[model samples]
Each structure stands twice: as structure tokens, then as C-alpha cells.
Target: MSGTIHSVSERFDFTGDELAPAYRAAVDAIEAGDLVVMPTDTVYGIAADAFKADAVQRLMDAKGRGRDMPPPVLISVVESLDALATDVPDAGRKLCEEFWPGPLTVICHAQSSLMWDLGETQGTVALRVPDHENTRELLSRTGPLAVSAANTSGKPAALDVYEAEEQLGESVAVYLDGDRVSGGQPSTIVDITGETPRVLRVGALSLDQLRAVAPDLTSDDDPAPDPTDAPEPKPTEDAEPTPTDAAEPKPADAAEPKPADAAEPKPADAEPKPAEDAEPTHEVKPTEEPAEASNKGENNKPDPDVRPAD
Candidate 1:
């Protein structure tokens, strides 16, 4: 609420391609720690300084989100990845090198102390460096912005500045109105949290597209076992066949089933007896005496009870 929603959407339009005032106003808004709705190559995103805890919390509350589900950090450029994430697994780092300035979000271990939360962060963070000018400009002035698709939690992402303004104007303080984002889709999200990088949500990028970078990525149920680690399959051999008319009878001295037999025989000396261990340990007894023991009354009143009955 500290800044105004200045009209810069027209400047961001790719058809018109004018972008001077839009960048300036958006930067000003971000510098003041205000939220901004802006265009990216992917979709319209509402952004706030990634490090400003209060502003970030306000963004989450406004969007009806909790700390457990946080927004992603949008950096101005790819080099910013190291600043926000630690231990960028090789697979994720490789993805960043190829997909940054494009529609792809790399999930990695967030710095232990990052104050902002993206939606359902799960002790991790989504990082992106979009291929858009207005977003880049705003990010440069604002530092990293914890942003998400400019739509309500479960709704479609806004594709243009005007639509974003219509949808998020009340929630965000500024809209860095730029060109209508192409693809009109969210970036592909891959979680590199485990031994293998996995596609949590597929988007603009196809599985084949991701494989070009991380050969280890797989949409298959199981990762292909490492060539060096896999045990070789056992060799199959023919077993000796019995003569058609000859059959082996059960051994008279055998006391247990043979490995290939269907039935197991008991020992000859073993006797069958009642299974005493299986007997019921507890018994129920009626406390009342038989009917013959009770005295008859002429009125036939309800039987005199000795003990209270449930």
C-alpha cells in the first residue's frame, strides 16, 4: 500500500514496444518495498523484494497463502542463482545454465536463512530468471522478487499486463505492465531435492526438452540403473528331463516336503493331540440361579433381583 499502481501496461506491449517510463516507475515501486504485477516472457507475475520479510509476508497473506506454501524467487539474471540458493545440485545448475532467460524454474536448496516463503516450499525454493525486460529492470532495482503467476492460488496465470491488472490490482501495489507474455503458460517446475531430479509439474518444456540438459531426468517410473552398478542377469540353462513313462515315488523315510513337492508329510511317530495352547483363557459365568430356585409369587411381580442388572 505504500506505492501507487501506475499505468505502465501500454509501454510493455510488444506490439508497441515502448519501454522507458514503465521500467522507471516499476523500479521506483520496488525500491519502496511495494509489490508489483509485471509481465515476463512466461506470464504475468506479482513480485516483491525476495529478502523483505514483511513485504513478502504481506504478499503471501494477500494471496491467502501460508508459510508452508511460498512463492518463487525471480532474479534479474541467471548469475543471481548462487546468491539465493545453496548447494545447487549439478543437474539443477546445468538446467539454470540452459533454461534461464526462458520459461523454466529450477528447484534447489534455499539458503538456510531466506525469510520469504514460496507456496508449499517444503524446505526448498524455486528460482527463475525470466526473459523479459520490464521484469529484469524491476528485479535489478528490487533485488530478487518472490513471485508467482499473477493469479489466485489455483487459477490460471494471467498472460497480459491488463489481465494481470484486472486480476491482481487490489492485491499487488504495482504492475510493471509490459508486453503480453508469450506461451501463456507457467514454467516447467523440476524438483532437484532427491538423488534424481524430477519434474514436479510439466509446463512449456517437454520431457524430451529437459533431457537435452540433464540426461539423468526421467518421467519413467524408475530411473535407469547405472550401468556399472547393475547386477548382470543370471544365465538360463536347460534342466534334465525325466523319461515319459518314469516317475519318482515319495521317499518312505522323508519327513518334510521336498523343494519341488506340493505337500509336506508329518513324521510317523508324531501323534495328533488337542492344541491346549489354543484353548480360550477366559470364561463367562451367569451369577443368577436357575428358575427352579426362585419362589413363585401370586402377583407374578417382576422377578426379585439379587444383583443390579444392566
Candidate 2:
């Protein structure tokens, strides 16, 4: 069955009155278990009533996906998460608080009481609250819708309704044209079913950004280790001694005297002598001429001879 395309205003009032005709048609189609292609914040999505197993199957068939792969559920408000999931962890609530109505899909334990089968979801379902105004209005009237990227299983996801129509052909019952959707990567997928929340796929929301809300949130690219569970380092026999052990003083009895302690005694005779006398002695002899010495003696010889004779 070829689908009919309806033109929708980009800035229409979402009070369920301005786009009454389009909303009426979309709600009717979804209620009748028919597939509808709609725009989301990240990309265009083909949606169906989440509670209707036949509608979900038809959605999977349109995407050429099998029961092994399940479609994510799109909710109008954050409160819907409580109804859809059981044991919604505090971390999951934190992620919804920070990134919901934007581009993050959280997977958690599905409500056991709900009568719905999304293929091989394994008792868990992925949910998101898109930021698009039109989609939110549609969700308000249609309740939770089982949604997936509007394209074939292997093909690129449609950024606009026309591309979705081209890829899906008549598989979708209604295509609400909301003009060209700002092209961007798909929403990030995070599974909070385990003790440690893990990111299955990275897309619009980054791991670091998600960590801001849930510090324990982990991604396939970077896994964080739990500090409390880290193992304490074991001491090895060859391990170096600690500073306290090495700083300890040795016993005084075992200490040896340093080189400054040994003194040699000096003998009394080894004292230094007077500097003047210490020099070598020399003989003092007058260098007088023989004639001068004889003259001097002859001049005094007469007096000396008279005194000797007396």
C-alpha cells in the first residue's frame, strides 16, 4: 500500500489544535497498527504503537529487521520511563534527567506486567524522549510508540521524510513532512541493566558528557575501573626498604672512627730552633794590606819596646 505524504508547518502550535488534521490522521494510523514516518531530533523514525505486537512486527518488517533486533520506544515525557521500565536505577534516572528530550536512548529492564514483545529485547527495552516539538505532540496523543530509524536495515538512516519514503516505499502508512531535518548522527544507546551502566553505541551524546550525570557510565571505547574494588599491591621479597627503615641509625658499638681521629705524637727535640741561630756560622777575617798593617805596628813599636825594657 503506497503511503500518502502530508505537508506540516515547521513552527505550528503543538496544543493539539493547529495541526489537528495531520495529528488526527497520524493518531488514527498508529491506533490502527499502521506504520508512520516522523522526524526526531537526531533523525527520522518509523513509529508504531509500542503495546501492539503486530504493529511492532510491521515496523521491524518495514526496516527489513528480524526479531533478533528490537525497536526503541519513544516517549513524550520523562515520567513515561517509570511506566515502561522496572527497577529503573538511579543512574538511569540521572541520564534521563540530563540528556532526555535530546539525543540519548537508555535501555533498562522492561515492565513485567506490560503485554508487549519487541522481538529479542531479552526482557529489556530501549527508550528515548526526543526534543522535536511535533513528535512530542504526536506522542502525547498516541502514547509510547515503538520507533526505529526510518530506512532499510543496512541503508543509512533518513535525515528527512523524503529520504525515508524513498528507502521504505509503501511500507510506511503515513509520512508527515516536517521539511529537511538538520542532519546529525543518531542518538547514543546506553544499557543500564547491569551494575555498571555501559554505552553500547556512541553517537550524538559522548561518554564524557554522559559521565557528567552518571559518573559510573562506561563506554565501549573507555571503560572505567571501580576504585573500591581495585586490588592492593602485594609486597615482594626483593622490594626496596622504605625510607623509615633505611633512615634508622646503626649501633654505636659497631661504628668505626673516621680518618680525623688518628694523631701522631711530636718529640720534645723536634721543636723548632731560633730562626737567626739556625743559619750556618761563617769565619770573620780582615782583608788588610801587609804594608798598612806593618806601618801601624812600627808607629807604636818605640813606646812598646821602652815599656818592655823597663
Which candidate leads the pack in TM-score? 2
Which residue ranges in model 1 land beyond 4 Å of their true spot?
1-18, 113-120, 220-310
For model 1, residues 85-182, the per-residue Cα lDDT tens digits are 88878887888889888888888888887666455666788888888865676678768888877876666778887777666556565566555666
Give the true-structure RMSD of model 2: 27.5
Best by lDDT: 2
| TM-score of every candidate relative to the true structure | 0.63, 0.67
